[model samples]
Target: MELCFFDQVKAQPLWVQILLVVGTISILKFSFAVLNWVYVTFLRPGKNLKKYGSWALVTGPTDGIGKSFAFQLARKGLNLVLVGRNPDKLKEVSDGIQAKFGKVQIKSVVVDFSGDLTEGIRKIEEAIEGLDIGVLINNVGISYPYARFFHEVDEQLLKNLIQINVEGTTKVTQAVLPGMVKRKKGAIVNIGSGAAIVIPSDPLYAVYAATKAYIDQFSRCLYVEYKKSGIDVQCQVPLYVATKMASIKRSSFLVPSTDGYARAAMRWIGYEPRCTPYWPHSLLWALVHMLPEYAVDAWRLQFCLAVRKKGQLKDSRKKE
Candidate 1:
């Protein structure tokens, strides 16, 4: 009988047959990855915020990605509890949301994550009392003014980074989680960074990266723990957005504007334990991982060193 393709392959040498099987498996895995990416990026419908609850609480809502998220949530017909250090900025954001989305209820909460969080957290608890806060955005965080070696990191900067990024997120989640658990439905989106997940390691910005890594693990644990209670917890990682925190003045294809990133982010809420929501950023993240670990490390080191140099020069000019 004439041999078919599989029969012909089986007739080949063992080593050649093994190679063919491995290649086929690899091709199939790559194809599936591409299909999944396309589905997530374009085809999936975002869950309804109304289903979760009517109110969404966003931390650091005065500027950057947090401010954008507040507006986007309001657009989705969700009332907002805006949290930030600056009361004026928080009020301004609330007003803006109210102006654009008439009939949207807005409340502002002033809490400095870097300062005495005990009082701030108490305030937050009071503000959201008796309200069905369906979504919580753990967005209040601080990063170094510029990259510096671990030894060069000041006491205050280290303290602030931990207190704000790590402790604040923990406390705020604690404050809101009970309400969610009791109600049996909620969503929590923690903002993480590519420094923690995409690259092999962050060289100069060690502590900052470590804090974000904590957020990633924390989110995953909560995701598993609370999923049965009908709550969705996610750590949304992004590479870069044009924001004051990143010191990027203009948005590009790779770096999205705050509004742009927030819009993409909303679609991803309540979905994945960890996600890079911006489609283009996902492509860049994939490319970064495909490179050798040593290559990524070297590139990160050089890039951060340049940032350090520019920061030093800027400081010197200020002293002058």
Candidate 2:
């Protein structure tokens, strides 16, 4: 059999022999990648979160992904420190979680990311003092309300994008890092976006995409810096979830609800430094990368333009 295999390869033309070898290697690599993804996404058991600590702190916990994460963490029996801008909304979420997870302790911290972050971060530090906060979820972020040209972005809108998305995440992580470092056991999950990682560009939403790019790099660096310290840092990049931020009101197979996304996210913590937790989002990420960058850029630009046109029309009607 070995002799026959050698003879068959020797009999083939040079190009055919090269093609056969290349094809075999490609197939093996692809198969291995698929198996790895399947194991990580489904078969692998998640780390026992309580081992990191007894409490989890989540920013922007009043609504959307942050809110969903707060509830999920509570379900895991981890006490929660819920931070958000709105006191009333924070109370509402705290009450809701308390009603269901009666044994879980919940503390509410009001931090307006777009406002004075020094004070906001101080509040966070004060709230977590002397508590064993093992998990920190930097989920508070904002994006363009509607796609617009970079030049069309107003001064205030631009400021808020940088403030809330980039600066806010950075400061919150800073406030929590010392505690985790002292304990030498923690997990920090920063919510990122596909605009920065999966796609080549985000077209008109330039500032939002740029801020998320910062998050991706920040998480990667922290992951490397703290790996030996027994702290896990990750940046989770999701495509679109049915959230108010995305203006996606309904969930579909491709677009998970906030709850569904958070559940998937929980399984991925303390693992990869960067990931797309939702399985469908991973599929989309693969597809997007398979295409040429220019093709994806053109498609994204067109899509954003349509969204902007619709938003403009709605604004005009409201004014009239």
Candidate 3:
């Protein structure tokens, strides 16, 4: 009996190993399906807004996705209130807007949402007073300092990301939501990533991606809860765009341009709960989503988990 047990353990056949792998994949697929079902149908309601009004507050307006939103929205003739850390950069963007659109009511606030997030949000609330703010873009966000696993991220930096990504976002959303709800009209578009679609094995921006995933989830819930009240909350999940945020996975095919996402976002602004940029990006996200569960998860793990060897985040050292 001992000999038989040893033989079975030692020889667990090739087919058996394959079966085990396939079975695990099957289980993960089912779980993923359930998650989609919950988020799509039961978890959050789809809210739609026909009129988002005129005044729009766009956070993170100094760079990347935020900048794209600012430029595009300005072109669409929306008054812009820029929220970001760098006042100089914000002014630069503001200047560019004025140059092109001939003065689009551009305003900038030099506030870092992560630093004393509540205070920053309060200041924003005060700054935009007397305006019926209809559109709120929670765009300021970041990810870096990948020295260790989730537990190993610098406490201060990690806290800042949480504050900006989750807490600050919540505060801004809650503050703006009342105005929309009272007016019975508003639009809130939260940016998310492909990493949220599948759990990444990549460790580099695990928390960043997770926070994005949370935004995705939270937006869905908000959309559902506020749809009837004429408030539209959309979770815009695009793949990795070529931004400073995902500096690690800089690939030609993998990275979409900031302008590309901005255009796609414009289309979805009128829609709700869009996993969008649907024509081209949707094609890619679909391929990734269709992949067997374990394979997708493993791909993420392999890409993200190997990030520890990379150095920590650093401010730009170029002499400005």
Quick one: how many clashes does candidate 1 have? 0
Q: What do the candidate models score in CA lDDT, each in turn?
A: 0.95, 0.95, 0.74
My TM-score estimates for the predictions, one after another, are: 0.98, 0.97, 0.77
**Could you give candidate 1's per-residue lDDT for residues 1-320 as a string of tens digits?**
45687799888999999999899999999999999999999999999988999999999999999999999999999999988999888888888889999989998889888888999999999999999999999999989999899999999999999999999999999999999999999999999999999998999899999999999999999999999999999999999899999999999999999999999999999999999999999999999978999999999999999999999999999999
Expressed as tens digits, the lDDT of each residue in 1-320 for candidate 2 is 99999999999999999999999999999999999999999998988999999999999898899999999999999999999999999999999999999999999988889898999999999999999999999999888889999999999999999999899999899999999999999999999999889999999999999999999999999999999999999999999999999999999999999999999999999999999999999999999889999999999999999999998998899999
Q: Which candidate should be chosen as best, given TM-score against the real structure?
A: 1
Q: Estimate, for each residue in 97-186, the C-alpha lDDT of model 3 and write its tens digit.
A: 889998578778778886776778787878777766777888877777543577677788888878888887888887778778888888
Q: For each predicted model, how many residue pairs clash, with residues at least 3 apart or on different chains?
A: 0, 0, 11
Q: Whole-model lDDT for model 2 versus the true structure? A: 0.95
Ordered from best to worst lDDT, the candidate numbers read: 1, 2, 3
Query: Which window of 10 residues has the lowest lDDT sum in candidate 2?
Result: 107-116
